[model samples]
Target: MTRPTALSVALSLSLPLAAHAAPDAAVVPDTTRDIDRVQVTATRTERAVSDVAATVDVIDREQMDRHLVQDLKDLVRYEPGLSVTSSATRFGLNGIRIRGLQGNRVRIQTDGIAMPTSFDIGAFSNANRNFTDLDTLKRVEIVRGPASSLYGSDALGGVVAFVTKDPADYLKDGKDSYVGLKFGYDGQWKGLLGGATGAFGGEHWSGLVNVNHRQGQETVNKGDVRVDNDRRTAPNPQDRDGRSVLAKLVYAPSDTQRFRLTAERNEDTTDTDVLSAISTAVPTPRAPLTSGMKAHDTQDRTRLSLAHEIDALDQPFADSLYWQVYTQNSQTRQQTDEKRTDGSRRHRVFSFDQRAYGLQAQLNKAFTTGSVDHALTYGFEGTRTEIRQKRDGYQVSSTGVVSTTVTPDAFPVRDFPITTTTELGLYAQDEMRLAGGKLSLVPGVRVDRYELKPDVDSIFAQDNPGLAVAQLKKTSVSPKLGMVWRFADQWSLFAGYAHGFRSPPYNDVNIGLTNVAFGYTAIANPDLKPETSDGYELGLRFIAPAAYVSLSGYYNDYKDFIESNVNTGRNAQGLIVFQSQNIADARIYGAEMKAGVEFGELSPALKGWALRSAVAWSRGDNRTDDEPLDSVDPLRGTLGLSYDADAWGVELAGTFVQRKKRLPPPAVQTNPNAPAASVYQPAGYGVLDLMAHWNFAPGATFNVGVFNLADKRYIEWSAITPGLITDRTLSDRFSSPGRTLSASLAVSW
Candidate 1:
């Protein structure tokens, strides 16, 4: 039998099979019929999904509960164009990946406040961006392309905005008091989750409090090898725990004026047995280097904010106003313990911390002049952030003699000096309606000024004898234009052009390191440039009472991409040198389609039946080196069928992914004695999932899901690394989980 390809399945599903369908009961709702849904992240103001020129996706509280969502991976399970990066050895998720970019390029925020940036050092320490709890969120919005025109720096790739629930959400329908409780279990991680919420409201005030906790073990995989060595494919043993708290208060003096205050905290801890690092090889057969390893990691975040809103004002400058002031603090600490085969021990500790304070405000006005209608919006944002990082280690012999100076590095060293960054931005946008509201035009622009100042202290000076830290100050302007034309009753065409950029980070600009014993060193660079991109998108949409379809294409060009720790030959002292540089130019293009229909439109007997499908394809190239970019994912698609009734619903979904075919050629070995370079290319695979929900009682619901029904052993392309090709024995370590089950129950009063 011939296997089906990604292109074939995508093209076949893009056709309309029936007319008008309900939302998927188990997964995300069909986008075709969600035209009336309101989203605010795309334009910084409330707008219907159909009116936005850019591609956007929304996940609400109802969807999250039905899907039994747990983490970032489960959040994007049905999204083809987005993914989460992870490490097999580290045993944790890194962050969200949008398009072909990940890490610091994509911006993540909660309640209009930015999250902490991710940072990594070698293989022992990694500070990730998984700081928010899913249970505390009411809605999540994702913008696909460049959004820097409105959000400023760090939005060069895209934006993810998380909106937390308010006291009013639970005190609706004239309820004076409310309470909710929830419990859940996940088979893959053997985890148990519990949460509780309470809310109270009166004539003039409202308040709410929520708390959630989870405890779990290592995630299960298909690998069965139990040997303790580098060739072992099974996941290392681990124990993890997490907790979060959210509280809010609101005061309303009148129908047009309101004030809100919020507080939140999240903490997570993990302990892992690093069996993958256990090896018996060393300088010679007589002396082995490592025998065993263990690690403990912790992360925490806290936030406080106050906001005010006023609407229906008669002022000349604005009809509505919203403003907020917030402060956030986050930290990460990691410790690694290693035992040498020759009766020696080593320990290392790494820490990273950040503090931020910011304020944001926006005003909106609507008026008419002559034959044109205008809706204008303007906003300003200012922020200040301070960052600090440190690493400490010690080595001891069998006789209990400890030393701070190890073989490769010294103890308590700073990778970069204490740095502070300040930024201020001003932006405005106008939406003009012309030709009797058939044509809409939007023009927006923003100007931002940023400054980075470094404080070199005694610790940094002692580590690097004679190094100079660089200070950066620059101003940037971003502009965007968008148009929507409705030529017919049910057809619309939209197009957009945007400019985006990301400022240079502290670690990349002034990194300092020395390894005299290993004959190598990495120095700082002061001439790094900010990365920039220009993006364009065009799309067409057809919306009818029975069916909905959308097709879009996009292209993006990037310049001055920064590549860190690049080898730049030897220094004057004959030591190998490395530095960060801006050297790459690239381009990425893609196409996507979404279509859905309801079987009920065809016949009354088929009522409550629906089908939804979507497909995405993309390609990227590194123009500077004339090679294919490996960060780009392969083609992918999803299809779902569901049946809904008054009290119960069920759905069966399938996810298909194509094999990775585009890769750069292997590097040539300049020295005959060096190892050869290679790449890992994953094979195409498809998986099926089944989900069901039942509303057995009033204000109570239960959801259950069975994923990977066939128990197929497969590896996600995003988890595969190029270094894995050199050691085939460790290939199974990257394999995804087998069949798993998840169930949850919630009750409200």
Candidate 2:
């Protein structure tokens, strides 16, 4: 990645207003001093985090400014239940696991729009863009646990929503302007610059626009032997450049009615070279060299929203109506070369492109049951996603001979074809208050109709005739129940039980016979059952006048969990490669707690300061097989203390992660020659961080920080070493950037 040269800056400045206002908002002035309360979209409706029915974590602008958090991974340390794993390249698109569940189970959104690009096989890798870049953000909200009833598919684990900054949120009296810049060195060169502006009539309308760019060089590890040849501190060779533009517009005719439109685009390019150690039967050990892996990815999104609140309805059954529509387009391409000492060489080129469109409308009604308040929420949501890929396979022998196995696949491969999935969901949730607000019962149900269509599936016709001749469709209904009892202002208890389901991905539901008519071995199964799970949870929330405490515990039981399996227990060329099948029951139980105190409560000397800490302990096991779940961390926690004065603020924080015990893959028809085993176990480690913020002037500020104070070595997960005979090595490991330093400056008027 290259730095933003003067030529690039001039080009950006020369763009016309039409190009800059592609989305919907306008740049307003004086936007930094308004709206102390932050609203989140965790639910269809807007509400404060503390009032939400579920556990929610809010990452505010102040924190983003203080930490210079440029991406999702940077924010993970502050979130109690969120964890991210990824390579050094920001283009690698980190994976987020919430409460031990990973992959497509979690729902990610921008504002109220759904981002459903996790359809490609490599989509889990470096095929998608991360939801970061602070120039266009207002705040972020994370909701933990099954949210299927509200979000539909892909919400089996949890939901993360990136709420873009609205012109109104940043503007003061609906008028504000601001510019922010960040510069840092993390054993490597890193820099960032961005700005935003807000302008609008106090109560009628508002608009905003923002742009930012970031660049950084690769980093190395200290005394790390995993990648033998790459002796540099940051051997994984990486360079990145990203630029984004966002615009928003809103109209509010009255306090009860509002309309909004938003648009954003992000373009980024990345280059990375990967090297790993390998030893074979040869005299001298040879390490595989992965050279010239380059990728370019882009994301564009647009949304339109409308909301209205009414107190004049003839009946008490209706209180508000809201409607929203959003669309997203993302494209990613990766070109790679692999070389090994065994004389085996391969050239791989692949591109993943996806488009998703969704629409949702909801009605919220309030009424009285006995002397208690009852609210009913009902909504309809529809989503359509299309995934397309183009990839070529190549192989070359040690004799300097090269052959092409296959060229780039067309729009739709004949065997697997292009898959399109569409879903329609109808759901309703009821929240009833009893015993003078001391007890509340919330129950929800969602019915979803899903249809997966493949353009062509000739290879699957031999086993199931329905696949090649036409298309297939599947659907399921999910339900949820929960209750909360508020004993006092400082003490509250809650419990919940929810049922969720997941349909097999189109590429993994093969069910066929011997190689035959379709020239392929396996077929597609139209009758596959949806994977299901039931979960029970209990929690407590205690908030005193000057302190806060939160605790939660949950037990989850799963049935028909999808696991990878080989159809015929034999590997033959041109065979239907893999299928998703039901596996034995699994259970996960864990506890999480976070507490904080206001220094002012202890004594006057400790005024203007605060202290906070959090810890989470989780364990998952396949009860039927008596084995731990892969990638499940046994223990994790964070401790932090901060102080603030009229002119400055400072904070110190530390994080700890315990080792992970490896486990086998989901399932198989029968055990193979070698049973699956653990390759590496990551040892526990800790690091400290420091941050300081100073208000230099009425509208000027500066922030400085140090990350990875100890430069400790650690690993997040394990990966396999590439070679003729693949070995294993832990990934996402490093000797922490060796005490990096960062600083930021900002001005607003």
TM-score of each: 0.94, 0.82
lDDT of predicted model 2 = 0.59
What overall lDDT goes with each candidate model? 0.82, 0.59
Model 1, span 308-334: residue lDDT tens: 888867689998888889899999999
* Stretches > 4 Å off in candidate 2: 1-53, 88-91, 119-126, 129-134, 174-193, 219-234, 275-317, 337-347, 393-415, 457-470, 510-523, 565-567, 570-577, 661-678, 718-736
Clashes of each: 3, 26
Best by TM-score: 1
- lDDT (10s digit) by residue, model 2, range 1-749: 01122222222222100001112222221112111223444345454444455666766677777766766667676665677644443244355778777667677777656664453332112455464465576566677777777776677777777767666555654344444343433333454444545444456776767766777655444434444343322445567667777776777677666676777777676666554322222333343333323333344333444333333343555667666676777776665565556666766556666677777777778788678898787888888888665555466767878776421221112334556888899988888889988888888899998888765444333224454332557677888887888888768887887777777666555322332322334445555666677877888888764677778888777776665433433345554434445655777778888788887777889986887788888777766567776645558788888888887889999887776554444332123776554345556778798988888887678888888887766654422111101123333333335567777777766
